[model samples]
Target: MSMLNAMRQKSAKAERSCVAPGEAGCDPVSDEANGPRRDTESTGSGLLQAVLTRENLRQAWKRVKANKGAAGVDGLDIDQTARHLVTAWPTIRDQLLLGTYRPKPVRRVTIPKPDGGERELGIPTVTDRLIQQALLQVLQPILDPTFSEHSYGFRPGRRAHDAILAAQGYIQSGRRIVVDVDLEKFFDRVNHDILIDRLRKRIDDAGIIRLIRAYLNSGILRDGVVLERYQGTPQGGPLSPLLANVLLDEVDKVLEQHGHCFARYADDCNVYVRSRKAGERVMALLRKCYGKLRLKVNEAKSAVASVTGRKFLGYSFWFAKEGVKRRVANKPMATFKQRVRQLTRRSGGRSMAEVIERLKPYLLGWKAYFGLAQTPGVWRTLDEWLRHRLRAIQLKHWKRGSTIYRELANLGATEHVAKRVAGNSHCWWRNSNGDIKRVLTIAYFDKLGVPRLS
Candidate 1:
């Protein structure tokens, strides 16, 4: 049978299984063995208990509309989903509450990873997206307080900077021995059964549990082949980050219980200790905990060393004469330069202004994070390189001596000087810094809205 027909048959079987014996409606207890009730208060704290309300669904719909992506397996785009939800959300909400809603099979697409390999990303249908958002709205508040302050990944109002600051604080206080732990294929390796078992301890509603189970079991299509994914949550799915965070909360708890000072942003964990011996002991315990949790430590990436010898979350920590110092790690800084080159390259076929516009947000955000470190000299160097890149892009756009000369004259260069500069036998970089820099001053580009690091 074709994929579509197969999916339809599978969905029908699932729906049939959801109906309890001797009952006329869908059963929330169809898989009661997998779900168990817990003591949860039915007040403002019980968001999951009141999750299926129309207002909640509308809020979820709004989040879906704001997210950018293509249509999923159901082929419904954001606009189409929004229009349909306007008229059909009440019914959808009712179905979800009744535990009769079946999520569509996830549409899988392979995306290029940073290491030149491809990773599979599962895209959920618009309806599933709405459900995931609603679930997140309810679960976020309940889960947030339980997570450690060290966990900055995927949490609202927290960031890598927060993680770095915590680590820096430890180092400045004389605890310099650090163990950096990296998880191997973390999202792809989380066991669904373990995740659900842990989640059950905190959540009570059977309907929500059923929905999460269905979401996890949803089929994934990769290269026209249907695959049963019995493990990790889909990386691109809306709820994956939250679920991953939940799965690792135990690690945080275990470390805290053992009195290890650590900071974690998702899979990246750094444990601070008083000395090398203490660091080694902490690393051993961390490995033990990870092993018990069925998680693999990328031994090649994990390291137990001094704070000055390790990099965490793209920032390198070192002990300076003044105090602890943090800077953008060398590798990450190089990567940033490569990305800037890629964005500003003439071969991209974008106009100079367009390239600068595209580069602004990335540059601005990077600067904001790195600005925490004392790097005025580094910023000036980068600013110069960026200007040279912009000049090369403009030269590519001008394309000829006459166009270059005219543009130079337009930017306030004398006719003779403009002509002489345009006819020079220098390379793009040389020409840019030589005569072009005089005409298109830094202030000129500043007025034109190009971003600066200095």
Candidate 2:
């Protein structure tokens, strides 16, 4: 009779752990690879009821569905899971409430870095992603209000532009010495102990804590082996960006307490000091603070320089003879030109119309991002350079001198100039800027729907 009574009480506890299926709440999972089940006090039944609901899971499903991405270790694509989520989520929810849900090992992927080498990322399953989104939805509201105003990372409604604006304000305020700092492998180096301890300080829900820990500690599935990660939030995980903000929030405090002018967008940090000596002192303080968090700064890449010397958010700031000015950073501008050159290669089999079609997406996107550039002269220069390339391609398509002459004549080029340009066999690049320039006017490209930067 006592044994029956104990079993009845256990069943009642499980029922109390979750709310009615029709209501909204959370769905959490644990890592099968973790050592033991050491958890904080379980969340009150009231919060669990609020976190774990069919409505909540469905909302998460809608969000994860919209942000379609590569499948996780399960090989289940977002599209493939939508049809089954209805039936599958209920069982998953039951497992979560029973403390038996185990998230699959994360799939390991390596993405090439722009400069060189590679960076690694771990992808979670579609189901896990949905659960993660649900977790993020609840956590963001509670913790976002507590973060530093200078932080403009993955938080809702904050963008890189805000950081840039703040940095510019600091420069204009006479904090011209910029300490360009970056964390070395920040995502992979985030200490789990530090992150979780901080989370506990803000949140007391043990179930939520366990769910996040599972996502962090889940082994990386690479080539059929489960490699355990002792620390660091895995990049590409939905919760990582927020977790990153949480881990780096202390950096903001360190700077603010010291009265240093600084702006941090994720791990890309810039501290502005009035003099070089102050910059040096600020760097020393930052290093000590990072040491406490176990995060390493990329000393090889970090520098203390003038505001004009460093690039922030793809724009370079310089003090012109008149006042401060902003322009596209040198490296990005060069890269944009390189991309245009590649796309407009005369050797490509694409025709003039096809080439314009191919270039539209890139050109339009570039113009949209850089349209706010303070220097209008750069756009005019880019416009001319691009037209020159297009004219060269059209001339190259004509191939022979006679063909070039006929095409140029058809393009409304004068007889004397057309003949002179066609006969110059030196190179199509040279001939392109000659009489052909008159024919391939800005209006001609405008008619062809070729997006012009200017």
Tens digits of lDDT, candidate 1, 1-454: 4322332344434444433323444343445323312212212213443454446655777777788677888788987766666556545544554555667778888885432346788999887887788889888888888888668898999987898999999888889889888889887788878888888787754556667877887778766776877777887778888888888989999988987778998888899998888888888898998887799999998888888888887788766688888887887788788888889887889997789789999888778777776667888889888888898878878878888888888878998779877896346767777777788888988987877787
Residue-by-residue lDDT tens digits, candidate 2, 355-409: 9999999899888766667888889999999999998888778788898888778
Whole-model lDDT per candidate: 0.75, 0.78
TM-score of each: 0.85, 0.85
TM-score of 1: 0.85
Any runs in candidate 1 off by more than 4 Å, and if so which?
1-49, 86-91, 110-120, 368-370, 414-420
119: Cα error in model 1, Å: 5.5
Q: How far is 350's C-alpha from truth in model 1 (Å)? A: 3.9
Task: Give lDDT for model 2.
Answer: 0.78
**Candidate 1: residue 365 Cα off by (Å):** 4.1
